[model samples]
Target chain A: MNKIPALSPTVLLAVALLIYPLIFSGAFYLDVGVTFLLAAISASAWNIVGGYAGQVSVGHAMFFGLGAYAPLLCYKLYGWTPMAGIPFGIAASVALAILIGIPTFRLTGHYFSMATIAVAELIRIYFGTWDLVGAAIGLQGPATARGWWDLTFRSELPYYYIFLTVLAVLLSFTYLMERHRFGYYLRAIKVGERAARSLGVPVQQTKIRALVLSAMFTSVAGSLYSVKTGFIDPESGFGILVSVQMVIIAALGGAGRLYGPLIGALILIPLQTATNTWFGGGGTGLTFIVYGGIIVLIARYEPGGIYDLWEQISPRRWRRKHAS
Target chain B: MLLLQVIVGGLLLGAIYALFSSGLTLIWGMMNFINFAHGEFVMLGMYVSLLVVMYLGGGPAAFGFGAAFALFVLGVVVYLSLIRYVLRGPMLAQILSTFGLALLLRYTAFWIFSANFVSLPQTSLSGTINVGGILMPIPQLVAGVIAILLTIGLHLMLTCTTIGSQLLAVSEDRGAAMLMGIKPDRMQALAWGLSAGAAGIAGALMAIAYPWSPSVGETFGLTAFVVVALGGFGSVPGALFAGLIVGLIQALSAFWFGPIYKDIVVYALFVALLWLRPQGLMGKA
Candidate 1:
């Protein structure tokens, strides 16, 4: 809250993130770290539209699925490195955003959300049955690194850094956007579409642009996931759970805030891994229960998320306000 | 003959879709709130019916009513405990609360039921009946008939009854209704009960013909959403017609293009429908 040291926390946080893998060099902690970064990437991407624009899309998984597939497909068909598929994934997701956004943006609130779900489900079902992409069996990356470009590695450390780099880029971009006119337009639309339009905000075009940007990042995150796991199953790629996770993580962190999702990922991914370790095979059910509980509590008490609670409770915030 | 059989089956399935979807549509109409956990209510209904049959040695009549009654109670409890609180929160909260409730309900069922698919033991509802030359399974036939009857009954009650009028009044304008002798809370609670009770019965009926696990709710929930949207969000009759169309499309497409593509066909049409008529087939713009 102090003006003299406002930038220190961010610098410290960056330093911590940089040193995290080194401090917890164990495979388990690194795996969780990598997962956290992946979740952070997707959740942050989802915030562009869902958080800022208040679109509440429950089907961003389709873009993630497309992203996951493009790289693997490139490897499967052309014997090229999976990383080479990143642009294709981004392109496809952008195109899909245009296709979906034009029609779906006409509907508002629940209607728009449901329409996105329908489109995503359609894509998932198609992917599940399409033999060219290995149908229900799904596609896999190289078992081991075929070459330097494969992006495959034995340790989780590489993925941690890779995902962290992506998250850093995404967060930096979002930070800039938050201070820009485009971000203002998105927030304006979120407050009231009609009012924003009345004030001369190009509501439809702005929403589509936000969605395109969100989809591009989401696709990249998906590409990273497939690269990390060396697998891309239909369920993992395009499942509703995948989409819901992005929403939940963003909501948990504090949607619309630049660092909300990163914080959410920091807490949630570790909790999830811990639960899985403790509960073993039945851990999934418990994890969902926990996730559900968090969502309910957040909705009931602090919809602004943990950061919002921190703002209210922090002594620094109080002192700063009183001083002003 | 085969096509007729398929059509009949589709209609029967459609009737069930209408049965559950009407409950969802009712909540949407009354409160402008979408209960993402509606399908979880149905899943619980299936389990309720299963429990009644397996433990109490109940027949179809008992289990059907038992499921409905249980879900009605649950509906009221959920509204009072969770939905009521979140209703005052932000739009995101409103959306995510029910979704969270959904995950909670679904996984709890998984924990309790062990994720194994279960079905009712053959009771009096089991058997096949011949209508003309085509054979119709009695469970589905009865389920369909009851679903249609109940949906129609619900429609009439809303149109003709005092309670229905009060409910509609609350939905129209809570402030105005509150000024009148009506307690908006009670009416809304009643609406949830009725909506969930309908879903409960739909689940019980579907259980007769299908093997299901806790995850069954996900599919049924999505299907109910499609039915509700396609029929027009708040229109009961629209739900009926739309439900039939979806069922028929799903059935025919599954039969023609294989089971995997059926959902694709349905969702494609649904998205296209939304694009063409965002208001839905029976909804007011």
Candidate 2:
């Protein structure tokens, strides 16, 4: 196994991303990078509860939609800036997370997942019919002048940097989560909720906190998504596909690991772009076929995901040496 | 009179839901594993019926039977090839494997059938029967009647037959069943076959009344989960009762409030019910 220094790889990656646009000067590549970063951030946020706490929520699109729509709605109704609306978006998403978590967190495993999907779908349907959010037509971000405050950018460069920053912040948060007492509590719950409760861990409280944190981060990503796309529709924002994609990305990379979602996003975003560029015109299902195939193979062969694959291939001596 | 018609319509729809959900509940009971791809099995059944009609010029009975047989074989193949292997893995693996299977089946249908919504050609089962002030569509009435009969038939076969006993024995304890000379693997595979076959029949019945695309499975899948959970995860009769209730609620709500709010009502009630009785309506606590 190669004994590469950890910080060096991260530093090199940062430098590569910093210079990527300047060297390539391609709009498509920049867009892909931005998407990758955004996905990483979303999946990382998902990881706080889903990966660490072992709560497989498939209704995260609810948060994403709230994040995306809250800002756009505030801007349209109250003339507030996108940046100013973000906190409100986060607050709304957290509040929703609590509401949902209080009931759903009582269920375990697949039941919990099913409840999340149902709740998300109910909300999506409600949004679709509500006339205030333009009904099924969906709400659009204000066509404000291009500026940092509005978060509307003429070039993809600024969006890329902003997404990169968000990813960095989320990654740091995940790193802290892994080291903190909260992280231990989450891991304990994941191992066995009954056992954790018997051990005096506040299982429900810990899960609720993790869910709130996860929702807060996911909502931020949603806000950024609307700013970048300039649209907020129930279908795109709260769609089951959106929820499924986040789970797939996090699970594909390695749910519990700090860097798992990043790795997953790195691989999947390119695959998505390439598939769209190639077979997109021919049919819409081919890309999903590939995704489905990858998911099955990964689940059957390596449920621990790409991170586990890395650990397996790495020399035992080195892995054991770095084990924390 | 309109309210009576709505109630009748809801009951009919609920019967179909029960028919499909019975298969899912069966598999869950047999193995304690939820088949996420069960909806795809129904979707495939619809496609199979469509193909039989289009290519072989089969009538409803022929096409329905064809779909059931084809899906039965597919289910057995899936169990032996995928479920058998994944069952040995982690709980997450089992969940995701079926989820993956659902995606694979759905997208494969998308690839072959494209995304356009398709309906079966109007067959001999068209037209409606008016009894008093209520008018019922023939195809839906037939489908609903058959669904109830089949659900009852499945329940009987499970409760009354020797094969049913053996199947139950396997599910109750694989090792003990094996010691008793029952092949748990074969019985489990049979369970899958029956489950998929039921889904196929339900799909064929549904195709008679609805236009659907490849992606329809997602909706049906969610509905099935709700029904299964509400009925009690592994209880067949529970699924039947819950399916009917869900169907009735959907119809009444859609009539009273509009189609959009129907799902919200069903799901809201479902979530609330699960909160109160996590074991489900029929399942033991």
Most TM-score-accurate candidate: 1
Worst 10 residues of 1 chain B by lDDT: B270-279
Tell me the lDDT of candidate 2: 0.87
- Interface quality of candidate 1 as DockQ: 0.71
Given candidate 1, what's the lDDT at residue A221? 95
Instruction: Write one digit per residue (lDDT tens) for candidate 1, span A103-165.
Output: 878766777677777778888889888999999999999888977689999988878888888
- Candidate 2 deviant stretches above 4 angstroms: A1-4, A281-283, A316-321
Candidate 2, B1-285: lDDT as tens digits? 999999999999899899999999999888878788888888999999999999999689999999999999999998988889888665557767887888889999999998899999998899999989799999989999999999999999999999999999998999999999999999999999999999999999998887889988877887888899889988889999999999999999999999889888987876787668777888888
In angstroms, give how far residue A250 of model 1 lies from its true place: 1.2
- List clashing residue pairs in candidate 2: none
Q: Show pairs that collide, candidate 1.
A: none
List the global CA lDDT of all models: 0.88, 0.87
